[model samples]
Target: MRSVFVTGTDTGVGKTVVAGGLAGGLASMGYSVGVMKPVATGGILINGEITSSDLLFLQAAIGNTALDEKALSMPYCLKTPAAPAIA
Candidate 1:
């Protein structure tokens, strides 16, 4: 199996777009794709659970809920909207 890691020098970059696009494209080509945000800040609480918008977006791009495992997709979600180092 192959894996791709996307990162940016700062926030507000096209990391999500690029990563999602890649995942979507691969899935469209009938390849098994898995997306993991690993760590995310600025998460919102929904039903007393921390939700990561990035993970949701990736899930949508993949066109499936197979990546719905919050514990695995977003292992470290912080409520504060700041960098992990600070949050």
Candidate 2:
């Protein structure tokens, strides 16, 4: 039951990429990986619906676990390109 926490020095620092890569690698090694973003700043528009690309990548990496998006991501998402507090 080993776990790892991935954090970033600042926003847009490729945390998502690193996390997804780790999860994908772990899953390939026969580990049941779970990903949690907790908080995110940017909003990705998909098929006329606003979603988080980070979460989507995580789901793809982990083979789409039963966890819902709300449980994986934060509630508030900012539309601007800046930080959530500023956007």
Candidate 3:
């Protein structure tokens, strides 16, 4: 099994685009792909549940929704603007 990890030194650096493109491309080639966005900060709070926008975008971009969108995300969520480490 092969895996790819997408990251950046800062936010808004096209990490999602790059990662999603790779996953989508691999899926188009008939490869089974799964995405796990381990950590995400500044998630939107809806109905008292913290959610990651990145995870949602990735799910749609890779055309993967095998599991619930919230299931693929980390258990803990932060609402800070900084990265998970900094926040």
Judging by TM-score against the true structure, name the best candidate: 1
How many backbone clashes are present in model 2?
Answer: 0
Clashing pairs in 3: none
**Can you list the residue pairs that collide in candidate 1?**
none
* lDDT (10s digit) by residue, model 2, range 1-87: 788999878778888899999999999999988777766556687656556777788878988834346544546555456774565
- Per-model TM-score, in order, reads 0.90, 0.73, 0.78
Query: Would you give me the overall lDDT of model 1?
Result: 0.86
Range of the 10 consecutive residues with the lowest summed lDDT in candidate 2: 65-74
TM-score of 1: 0.90
Off by over 4 Å in 1: 66-68
Model 1 clashes, total count: 0
What would the per-residue lDDT of candidate 1 be over residues 1-87, giving only the tens digit for each residue? 999999998888889899999999999999999888988899988778888888899988988665347787889988889965577
Enumerate clash totals for all models, in the order shown.
0, 0, 0
Q: In terms of lDDT, which candidate is stronger, 1 or 2?
A: 1
